[model samples]
Target: MSAYAEITYEVEDRIATVTLNRPEARNGYTIRMADELGDAMDRADRDEDVRVVILTGNGKDFSVGADLTQGGFDFDPETGPDAAWQEPAGRCSKRIFTMNKPVIAALRGAAVGGGVTITLSCDYRLASTDSRFGFVFVRRGIYPEGASAWFLPRLVGMGTALDWMISGRVFGAEEAKTAGLVHSVHEPEEVLGKARELAREIAATTSPVSVAVTRQLLYRMASAESPFPVHELDSRLIGGLGSSPDAVEGVVSFLQKRPPEFSMRVDTDQPAYLPWLNK
Candidate 1:
């Protein structure tokens, strides 16, 4: 496992846990941390030992978004002269969109600004009872970075997304779930446990090859309009994965009424672009 000032990683029972470690600062993302996280996700996706990835924060708050007081990067449009604000935006965008493995965010604290965007990127999201979520970009005199401008509206609908982002108001875990941001809420202590449990369930039942293909397809469909090209991509992916060793193992295991022993290795040589670049 690599060391990161803002995050930590561990693997157990085929589940890879990626924790936001900077609790004192509310797990805020620094530029370097963002890059490290992206690299970590890439590693997790490529490693056959890892079947699922859980994302969580160490302290009371999940993440408060970008570290503003730390200096170097300024999001304040009034104070900043030009488009320097887009630097952090671009970095975060890359991190959220490029993760290949299924990510489940275990939320125990406030998820604000870029934090909300991160949570939205995950395949599944679980929040603790004490958790709170919001987008504070408007209050900070900036727009939501890290795909919030696009993801939020799509996840919660245009009207709700606009209201939440523009108001910059804080919402509790229950409200977040109701608004379709979080899938479920659990006790503070059970937050990560529930996330892990869910991950294990997925790992136990889902076909590794199919899961990866589905994740890619869903991501591509989120922003793309041309169904023809998307279908072509899907066909190609399925065609290749259908003949994989894992695919055969999955079917054989089902026939034998036993758990599949998935080979974690997967091919990812497909073309990078096919719409939904913002996600």
Candidate 2:
């Protein structure tokens, strides 16, 4: 709800679009941009009507990464009102990582370093055919930020992550898709449109509460050391189905061959017993 100077947040028809508005600078990343992005994402997440989020930039490039022209030192965290200090990109990535709703990234032109890393947590990435990607930290005599080391390998495997990070080479969209780093590729002008189509599909066919719970379960439990905890949690989730109106609607609608009219809301209907939500 607060005003944003560096980015734009707009919601319509159950989807929220958060855009990097600095097209003139190729949407260069900055400390202010990072804060604005984190706030916009949090705003969308808190809005019960927003079932999905589309993240993209204006103009040709998604971002040229951090704006080193004005001393890249500005992106690092020395201290803040929050109890802990986190790198700017990490702050955005972490917020996206924990969201109940799905976040999709639409990339075009150049998306290197922090630009690409900041989007690593998005559920889907739709890249423009002309998109260029890189993890060019080593070549620039710096380390990668945005907790990319943890996110990159999980998306593209250890071997590929190492190859890209160690070599610090830029690659095109097809290679990114082939390696599972991106979900799909589209024409330069169609990237954001494709993202919106995908968002609308999710918004139309899914229960908000169900999507929220499932998204959190996958991210929160994917790295677990064992399956015992997951199964235990799964049992708990399934047992709650008896009390879930959406669950019954899902089955009844299928039997009747009709579009489901689910009545669950993410903010109010999520299971109160979830460990993360409870904690």
Candidate 3:
């Protein structure tokens, strides 16, 4: 019943797995795939049963970047870059940035250009020993897209982002992990399994509403100008959750030596001041 054309979405337990299905083409990023990815992200965010999402490819490569086989001169002659052509990777990245559930990118092979930028928006990335990454936009006679200019610097620092982007060179998974681009690296066939295990761990241990609010707060406050605003937000959240049912259950369960079964649902129980209006 899934409407996706280039991706496969399957939900098991509390984890939603979104797989890029274009293996023959190395899971290249295309307009249709971008739209579908955004849709899949929305689905995961809206589904209360889905606590986490894992993004991976159906083939050897996570993604080889954009598909160029559409031939040259495909852009509108009159509008050019200003044409209504929104960058596909940007669409997917934007959705991931705002998702309620955490996303983990599982990379096995090549992740170039759009490939690298799209994953940059995810909360965590796990790669295989055989994985490779490239920021080859400059080499392709273009600059980085998918808001990578902002994401890359925030992730690996300005100097590292500039060096890799300027050089447009391919790098291995170990280098990426050392640069703070990825959380962990495992054997090729174990990459997706490891990602799933992590997702399950989070889903099992965390409260959905708390996780959603905390994720937004962390990402939003990361670029804030001052700590005062974050303190205010923290106070507001704590005041709201302090006496809630989940809070009581969490404390009681700990005292009794048992797992806490939080009763609040994110959809209806989220604090009124959530999302930080100014952010």
Which candidate number maximizes lDDT?
Answer: 2
Candidate 2 ranges beyond 4 A from true positions: 74-83
lDDT of each: 0.76, 0.92, 0.88
Superposition error at 114 for model 3 (Å): 0.7
Residue 248, model 2, lDDT? 96
Candidate 2: clashing residue pairs, number: 0
| All-Cα superposition RMSD per candidate | 3.6, 2.2, 2.1
Task: Give stretches of model 1 more than 4 Å off.
Answer: 74-86, 234-242, 268-279
Candidate 1 similarity to native, TM-score: 0.84
Tens-place lDDT per residue, model 3, 1-279, is 268778999999889999999999999888778889999998998899999999999989999999877443336657676646677788899889988799999999999988879999898999999999999988989979999998998899999999999999999999999999999999999999999999988987778888888888888888889899889888887877666888888788889988878888877887876665334
| Best-matching candidate per TM-score | 2
lDDT of 3 at 243: 69
Q: Candidate 1, 150: how far from true, in Å? A: 1.5
Q: Model 1, range 1-279, lDDT digits (tens) per residue?
A: 467667888889999998888888888877666776776787787787788899888889888888866764644556774754456545654565565568898998788877767667788889999988888878988777777777777677888898898899998988888988889999999998999899999988886656765776776676666788777776776667665777788889999999887764544433344343234
What is candidate 3's TM-score against the reference?
0.94
How accurate locally is residue 143 in candidate 2, as Cα lDDT from 0 to 100?
Answer: 96
| Residue 71 in model 1: lDDT | 65
> Ten-residue segment with the worst summed lDDT in candidate 3?
68-77
